[model samples]
Target chain A: MVYAYLSILGMALILGVMGHRHTEVNHATVLHRAWRQLAPLLIRLPIALIAASFVGELIPQALFGEWLGERSGLSGVVLASVLGGILPGGPTVTFPLILVLERAGVGIPQLIALLTGWSCFAVHRVLAYELPTLGWSFVWRRWLVSMILGPLSGALAIAWL
Target chain B: MTVFFLLLGAAAGALLAERQGLEAVTGALLSAGELIALVIPLVIIAIVMAAYAQALLPREIVERWLGRDAGWRGLFIAIGAGAVTPGGPFMAFPLVVGLRAVGASLPICITYLTAWSVLGIQRILIWELPFFGVDFVVLRLVISLPLPLIAGITAQWLGEPGRH
Candidate 1:
């Protein structure tokens, strides 16, 4: 969290100087776009966070430990990978919920799997963006190869880390 | 819509907590508030920074490096460009198309996409770091860094369509 804040502050400072030098930077437009993006996030994030919090409270720690914890092994990675694909929303929505799960007892390997799945094979992203822009062939090819990433990485993390 | 579902989820959560006890509801709200506080400012700065970062990398220059004859160099270049190519799929996918039009090979393009998805600098700086903190983000990046290149190499080895 400290790193996140400090980095943002540094970026902001650097961007300010870059904008000053580049006549085309257009700070006003960037700020407007950022604010516009924030509007939707503001509504959705609060709701999701609250819901996730309550769900976290409801789920027994033992249940999460049993399913997604260290001892759950490869199956946990597989489950996390699958769930990562199904979860709605982009990073904003998924990451917060991952935090909830992490607090609830999910292991690092499973978390790695979950994040990889979401990043590589997010069904919604493929449908909405990749399909329209790159066509079905590209999507399928990418999907076939990319599917191995999450589980493979998760397994490696478990074995090595 | 996603909004409707989220609203429903929040409502259900609130109701369940209320039924369990007012204390549960209070706890949920407090937790949510704390998370929101952590996320909002980071998101704003991250998004803004990403916008700036994207602007710094000229599209034409990036595309030029992905030419068909670039070979392994092209693949490596694609991975590097993809990592820094800010914004969401909306921006990145089209950029891939642009690279293809300019004569980038299939393996290179696939590598680019994989890199963008797995090690995207913008996404990591903005979303991952803020949410998961430095240790998790760094570990994930270390593990993920070579993925796109590996995918590209594998695709090339198999003679996947467009590699030629």
Candidate 2:
């Protein structure tokens, strides 16, 4: 956690300096924008963390392992992909839940599938953002082309790793 | 959504308390508190960094590069832009709309969205690297590297027959 914090802080400082040099906006503007973005996330974060904890307690580790462990194979990957696609909210919610799943014994391959599915088949993102802006035809085209990626990556991971 | 999550947490806490006693609920709360304490600082830094990066990025150049038709080169440009573009769907989807309005092809747009979704550097640096660690990030990147290109190519092929 400390490593993550310090490295990111370093990057933030560099970016901050660069922005100050290049952009017309001052540090105050940048800080204000960040705070605006952070506000909703701040609300969501604690709730997500608390929910993840309680839900993690509810999930039986043995059952989760049986369903999505290293030995669970293709079925596990597919199942994980579906779950990932259905996962609601942003990284704040998703990552914590993923951490919980990781601790509960989901295999690396399944995790890959899960993350890929979340990225490619983000149903909420599609409905709320993509569909309205890009239209139905474009969304369908993108979905058709990208749908196989998650399972394909997972299968490769299962084979190689 | 916050309300939904809060209700869910409350229900789960109730169930846990009922089944395993108040001690288990307290334990869960403590665990949640510990995780929050560990992660909140990182989240704050990440948001601020993202804001700065977003401000510094050259938006006009991105739109100009994406609006051109350079075939494979255009696809690569799309990939690069998508990976670097920050914020969420609100940011990305509107950018795609703008690019499309300026004559970007469907395949390039698809590729850009795919890259943004799977390989975004912002998400990797802020979320994945911190939560999953370096090895997992690297492994996932290696395995998923071909996805945006594949999506682009497939979209191009599908569109080829319909081109007038």
Candidate 3:
């Protein structure tokens, strides 16, 4: 965690210097834009985290293991992808749940599929952000092209590992 | 959205409290605090970096490279940019809108989004590496590497049938 923070901070410092040198936008404007973006996320961060914790606790580890364990095979991967797409919230919520699921004996392939599904077919993100901003045409096009990614990747993981 | 999360949290907390005790709720809060402490700094820096990158990026260059005529090169550029670009949908989607306005092709845009979603370096570094460890991350990355290109080619085929 510390390493991640330091590396990203270093990147930010470099980008800041570059932006100052090249962009017409001044430091004040860049900071203002970042602040505008960060404020709302900061507000929601704790609430989401708390919710994730409680929700994680509610999901029994054994139950998760039974359904998504290594022996569960292709059906487990498919189920995981469907659950991943519908899983609410963002990384804050999803990653922690993943940790829990991992501890519960879920297989590597299933987890990979779950993560892919969450990233690609995130129903919440699509409805709340993509549909409104990019419109249905773009959404449908992207969906048509990438819909199989989750399961396909999961199957690949299974084959490779 | 915050409100919805809040209600969900409260409801979940209440259920846990009933099953376990108030201690369960308090434990959840404490753990949440720890997670926030670890992640907040990373998120803040990532957002700042994204903002600066947005400001510094040469719009004309991006447009020229990602335009309709750029073909395979455009797809590659989109994938690279998407992998490096940080933040959530708010940042990515707006950038896509801007790029599209400047003649970035649909296929390139799709590729960019797919790369961003599946292979964002920042996300892998901060979230996946920490949570899933090295082996899992490496395996997932290797297996999923070709996804954006595949999606991009499919989009190209569907969006421009005559050209293909």
Candidate 4:
């Protein structure tokens, strides 16, 4: 990370010295850009939680916990992936869910797949931005790759670990 | 449209989860809870990040590295770049779209977006290791190692727009 930062610094210096007046350049613009980028998530996450909390309050928590936990078979793996797509949250959000899934008997392999899906694809993203910008072809390309790789990764891990 | 589908899908998953077992229900709720838990923190982070993204990392930087001239090196760059590139991985979709609009290749864009979320530096160092342990994290990194390559190659192999 430090190396990356240094590299960025070096690049900035070079850009500065070369005296290339990039009218495109504005330090303030980037800061604002980052915020503009993240604003939706700020709203979306909490709403998702309120809905989820309802499920937590009403749903049969302990019963399903046993089912999804390690004891589950291949079904667990498939279930894990599907569930992953449903929950869209950050790392702090993902970890606790993983722990809970483990306690609920979600197999390790399936858990990995869930994380893979969580990490890779958000259905919301595909619609909100991916398809329009990158094209369905590009979007689908990773989805197909992930479908194969994600499960394979989990399967391999469970086998060895 | 996508949000509609996600909500619909979640609802369906909920039904299926309900039927699966007691455990599935709990797992689902936990999934839901994670989202709820993230509200405050992710929002704060998002606000800060959005502001930052607006200021730093010009459109040209994204275009230059992930652009037409980028070639194969761009593939690898896409993966590592994901972590550093700001936004919720989902939210980053828009930025990726913007990049493509500016001329990033489809393959590089796809791979980069995936790498952004899966291998993001923040998630890797801050969240994943602490939660899953070093071994699990190592395994994850190892597994994720080749993903961008696969995604990029797949996109490239499939050919350009209008081919399909």
True contacts kept of each: 0.56, 0.78, 0.81, 0.32
Candidate 1 lDDT tens digits, A1-161 = 88789988798779767976887778787777667766777677777777778777776799899999988999999999988867767876777678889999999999999988888888888888878777776777777778788897788788778
DockQ, candidate 2, comes to: 0.67
Candidate 2, lDDT over the whole model: 0.85
The candidates, ranked best first by TM-score, are: 2, 1, 3, 4
Q: Candidate 3 lDDT (Cα, whole model)?
A: 0.81
By descending lDDT, how would the candidates be arranged? Answer: 2, 3, 1, 4
Q: Candidate 2 lDDT, tens digit per residue, B1-164?
A: 78878998999999999999999999999989987877777778888988888888757778888885757889999888988898878778879888887788888998899999899987887788877887888899988888889889889876622221
Best by lDDT: 2
lDDT, candidate 3, at B74: 83
Alpha-carbon deviation at B124 in model 1, angstroms: 1.8
Superposed on the true interface residues, model 1 gives a C-alpha RMSD in angstroms of 2.4
Report the C-alpha displacement of residue A154, candidate 4, in angstroms.
1.4
- TM-score: the better of candidates 1 and 2: 2
Worst 10 residues of 4 chain A by lDDT: A1-10
Q: For model 3, how does the per-residue alpha-carbon lDDT over B1-164 read when each residue is reduced to its tens digit?
A: 78987898899999999998999889888987887887777777777788887777655666666765767888899998888776678768877777777677788888999999999887786578656766788899998889999888888777732111
lDDT by residue (tens digit), candidate 4, B35-140 = 4553344334434434344344555566667766677888887777775665454546666766666666768776887787677755554345434556666677
Off by over 4 Å in 2: B160-164
Docking class of 4: incorrect
TM-score of 2: 0.94
* Rank by DockQ (best first): 2, 3, 1, 4
Model 2 agreement with the true structure over A1-161: per-residue lDDT tens digits: 56677788898999988887884857888899889988987888889889988988988999999999988999999998888988877787788899889988999999999999898988888889887777777878888887788888899788778
